[model samples]
Target: MTPEEFAATFERIRREVRTVIVGHETLIDHVLTAFIAGGHVLLEGVPGLGKTLLVKTLAQSLELSFSRIQFTPDLMPADIVGTNVVMQDAEGRRYFEFQRGPVFTQVLLADEVNRATPKTQSALLEAMQEHTVTAAGTSYALEEPFFVLATQNPIEMEGTYPLPEAQLDRFLFKVKAEFPTAADLVEIIDRTTVADQPQARVVASREVIRQMLRLAREVEVASHVKAYTARLVRATHPGDPRSADMARRYVRYGASPRGVQALILSAKVRALVAGRANVSLGDLKALALPSLRHRIILNFEGEAEGIDADAVIQNALDETPELEEART
Candidate 1:
């Protein structure tokens, strides 16, 4: 698809989702960006902030099979990824049949994912990275365009387990769903209290979404823009002498290679959504917060002081705003 057609299609999908969602334009945009990039998203928020509703609406607006798993401490790996069951055939011969779980769907909403134990959570590690599930000594390839949009309560919240760093790394963007403003809450009440409720109509089919994905990958990125993206990521590392002051003082670890991938890929999506054919420095910078937030780890001192990862990433952005020659 051409850039204009790409932008038009993206806007149409977003508009359809907006029919039910009240605000959170950026949240919706980032979710859509990750979806097109064929990457999963991790949404962090407290309950009742519409995180679940947002995921549902997105699935509804697109032509994809949708399923939801309300994760809990008792939830098991087999529950999410499915388990084999004994079955009988015509001759009374018994065989194990794999009963597919909710994870098999095209769009999966893992509500309160962190509520589940890490063992249960690890079940998704293979599926998220490899797009396949191994069960009963057999490998099952998930349907194309599979995505896991997981929502987790804040780590400090009661009964919530922090997602292991490995799982966090798998998500393309860690979007924090903030509480709505009073005005937005009023609007939300108005929308939900009425007899008629809004619903999203499908705007794009799987083929169209796949085409958009190919187009996003085709968006051009100048060498300097790429180098600049790398610089921003490097500056988040405390050990790097060139890192931002806050990073050097507060950060324990830097973003991984996947962080770089998320930034570049999401930037391309942003560029296309903005009707641009080439990715610019601004595109990468605009995405740095969500793309890098969950990837950066804080040190003891930083944690004691309650340093926000967004603050650290923003500091890095300020320190290295452009590409420069490596210092000897």
Candidate 2:
């Protein structure tokens, strides 16, 4: 699809989703960006902030099979990835059969993902990264265009197992869902209090989404723009010469290469959504936070002082020059 066509299609899907979701335009855009970039999203927010509703609405707006998994401490790996079971055929012969779990669907909603133990959460690692599940020593390839949108409550820490860094890196974007403004709250109340609830209509088909993903990959990146993305990522590392002051002082670990990959991929999607043929430095700057926030680890002092990852990323953006000449 052409860039214009891609943008139009994305806007149509967003509009359809807006029928149900209130406020948070930026959040919706990031979610859609990750979706078209063929990446998963990790949404951090308190309960009743529409995180779950957003995922469900996105599924409704797309023509794909949807599955919802309520993650809890008692949840097991087999519950998400399915398991092998013995079954009897019509011929009366008993054989081992694989029972598919919720992860087999195209769109999976892992609600309160952090509430589940790390073992149970690790079940998604293989499926998210490899797009396949191994059960009983047999591999099952998931359907094409598989997307996982996981939500976790940030305020409730008790009994919650924080997602390991490996799992966090798997998500393309870590979007923080904020509470709605007063007016938005009024609008939300109006929508929910009435008998008629808005519903999102399917605006994009699975094939169209796949095409969008392919087209996003085709978005060009100039040499300098690509280098700037790399520099930004490198600056997050404390020992790197390009490291920003805040990153050097506050960060314990820098973002991994996966973080840089997500930055470029998500920026390409952003460019396409903006009807641009190529990614610009501005695109990289705008996306740096969500793409890198969860990837950057803070040190003890930074944590004690409650340093926000977004602040560190912003400082990196401020300090990192986009052009080579400006670097000097």
Candidate 3:
């Protein structure tokens, strides 16, 4: 599809989502970018902010199978990726069969994913990165357009095993779901308190989403912009001169190559959604945090100083905004 066609399809999807989802337009847009970019997303928010509802609505608005797994401490890898079992046949011979898990769906909702143990969380890493799961020395490929939308409660740390950086790196964006404004809250109440809640119509199919993904890759970017993306990610490292003293004090590790890839890809999608055929520095600036927030690793100093990964990423963006766009 052409860029305008891609934008039209996504706009319809967005309107469908807004029928039930009242607020958080930016968060919704980031999620859409990740979808078209063929990347997973990690949503951080408190309960009752409509994070789950948003993902569910997206699932409903697309022609895809949706599965939701409520992650818990006792959840196992086998519980997510399925396990092989021996079954007796009519001839009395036993045969090994695989029972596919919830991860087999095209769109997966891992609710409160941080509640699961690290081992269980790691189970999703292979699927997220390779779109396949290896079990019993056999690999099973997931469906095309497979996407994982994992949510976590930011306020709750107790009994939660934080996602290791290795697993965190698999996601494309770390979107933060914010609370609704008073007007939005009133609208939410006005809608929910009544009997009828708007339902999202299926606006796009798997083929459309796939086409959009291909179109997103064609969004042009200047060579300097590409270099700037790489430099911005590198500047998050401790010894980089562009990094602030606070970053050097607080950062344990910088983002990986995947971070730069996500930064560039998501920006491209953002530009397409805005009806642009080429990525702009403003696109990169707007997507910096969601693309790199989870990628940055904070040191002990950050923990003690009460500085979070978001702050470090924001500082990096502030430092690089001028330089990143100078070529433009």
Candidate 3 lDDT, 173-247, residue by residue in tens: 999988889999999999899987788888998888888988898889988788788778877889776666657
Name the best candidate (by TM-score). Answer: 1
Error of 3 at 121 (Å): 0.6
**Candidates 2 and 3 compared by TM-score, better number:** 2
| lDDT tens per residue, model 1, 66-112 | 99999999999999989989999999999988999999989999999
Instruction: Report every candidate's CA lDDT.
Output: 0.91, 0.91, 0.88
Can you tell me which runs of candidate 3 are displaced by over 4 Å? 321-328
lDDT of 2: 0.91
Ranking by lDDT: 1, 2, 3
Measured with C-alpha atoms, the lDDT of residue 113 in candidate 1 is: 95
Residues forming the 10-long window of minimal summed lDDT in candidate 1: 319-328
The per-prediction CA RMSD against the true structure, in angstroms, equals 1.2, 1.6, 2.2
